[model samples]
Target: MSVDSASGVTVPEPVPAGVVLRPPDSSVRRNQRLLARLGWLYSAPALLLVAAVTIFPIVFSVVMSLSHVTVSGSGFALGGFTGSNYSAMFGAQLWRYALEFTLAYTFGTVLVEIVLGTLVALVLERLTIARGWLMALLLIPWAMVTVISAELWDYIYNGVYGVGTSILHDLGMQQPNLLGTPTAAIISMAAADIWKTTPFVSIIVVSGLVMLPVELTEAARIDGANGWQIFWRVTLPQLRPTLALAVLFRILQAFGLFDLPYVLTGGGPGNKTESLALLGWQTMFSDLDFGPGAAVAVSTAALTLIGCLLFLKVFRSQVGKEEL
Candidate 1:
């Protein structure tokens, strides 16, 4: 056998090593591929939904703004084209009224919310008893439906049998019709907004307050810092980011406000409370002028974007300085 093996060029026996080779399981590879595909499949519905709901509408609106469309006619048809809508908006004095009212509304509401919200936050921070209950109660205004709050405040500002009128009479003053006069109506609507939304701003600021390091405040106190000094130097610096965020949110909300003003004032008393949104609504629905209405909406959106960008830039600068 040995002689025969040499003659046939026999091969040596294989030696055992530390390593082994094996084929990957086809099932495992298939399962991994299937899982990856399934993950994407699961997310497809949400992506499609977002595209359909948000992206589609935005694109449609942009296109509609460039063309003329009527609510009663074929929706967003391309044939009814005109630049006259935007030209009319720019040339008319109505734009000035809308702009002035929008600015007034935004500033009035945001200013009140910030000041009153900070005050409330400070009060909440100082409280030691039933703080949770108080916080919950403060949130009630924000939790209520916006339309309901508008109606409630509307009734409160009513000339006869209104609580506001009653209070004025009790104070030995003639009860002025708050919702009738232009100045008073604007102030009254803004006050209603402040009452409803200040709690939201307070909640944001309170979170910032709660997260502030006690050590910094204590150090300030040990350095003989008074209440005002501590607040200005130690507390406010830490809360700048929160305050920025709160103000930005409040501003945006106040800028786009429609339902409350619509429900309460109906943009009445000589268009004193007519915000950009309300004006757009009137143009589109009341006048059946879709082109101008869409133009107003587009302009409003651009203004909002500019405002937001400015806020973000300022916020980033402040945050950077704070970090340093």
Candidate 2:
């Protein structure tokens, strides 16, 4: 202790155990800002690449959708801004039909795939033998390119010499023109999609299942919970987020349905199987209507974004309710 010169009062020296507060050095702040700038410098190349590939195309599509676009011998020429593209898209009957077909097809296929995939994952989770081999086999369809798979399905649905046709003929179904009719074409295309994509969902769910804590199920079993009870009370809730992730991925991919329908049915039998993506493709490439085609693409992207947002909101609310 010492007396202060100005106040003539005894003051205690600071204890070694007490924290001493001081203003941060300007050098420290300068160093932090320098580090942040370097970080951004390092990230700039990849960010520019993403902008070139993804953001530029999306912005260009939106611009084309909202403008008058013409294709010349040189390339696409953009005219003055106009709403005619969107107006034409909204006025078209094919647009309405394609929107409906895309939504319905996405809903049906995604729901079926999720259910079947979850079941497959559950079974695979319980397997004690050849699990790795079985998983590899299951992924074969998903690993195959969509165009190749679609071609394979096209052969299988061929009216004359298809294995499927032969089997059905043996069972007395006279004419199973799988891709010849509207309803059959839609169903056949959906079947092909589900066959190739279900394994993707199964892989995702299997990963989630592998990460799940075993203690919860074990404790539930000790509490006299049956398999079904344990699954319902313990597993399903935990798997909700995993299922939501699978659903989101499926929704995005399914809403943009093109390759399967294009390769298998060619959107034929009165354009009954034409999806939004296929419609956009036909409008852009076949008719060379870039503006309206861009509008269709933009509309489809907007719808997909809205659908995913709504699903996430509903899922969050459900999770909140379960927590409550």
The parts of candidate 2 lying over 4 Å away from their true place are 1-24
The residue-by-residue lDDT of candidate 2 on 1-324, one tens digit each, is 989999999999876776876657997899889999999999999999999999999999999998888799998999999999998899999999999999999999999999999999999999999999999999999999999999999889899999888888889999878888899889889999999999999999999999999999999999999999999999999999999999999999999999998998778888999999999999999999999999999999999999999999999999999999
Worst lDDT run of 10 residues, candidate 1, spans 1-10
Task: Output the lDDT of residue 211, model 2.
Answer: 93
- TM-score of every model? 0.85, 0.90
Per-residue lDDT of 200-284 in model 1, one digit per residue for the tens? 9998888899999999999999999999999999999889889988988888888887987799889988888898989888988
Task: Give the least accurate 10-residue stretch of model 2, judged by summed lDDT.
Answer: 14-23
Global lDDT of model 1: 0.85
Model 2: lDDT to the true structure = 0.94
The alpha-carbon deviation from the true structure for residue 204 of candidate 1, after best TM-score superposition, in angstroms, is: 0.9
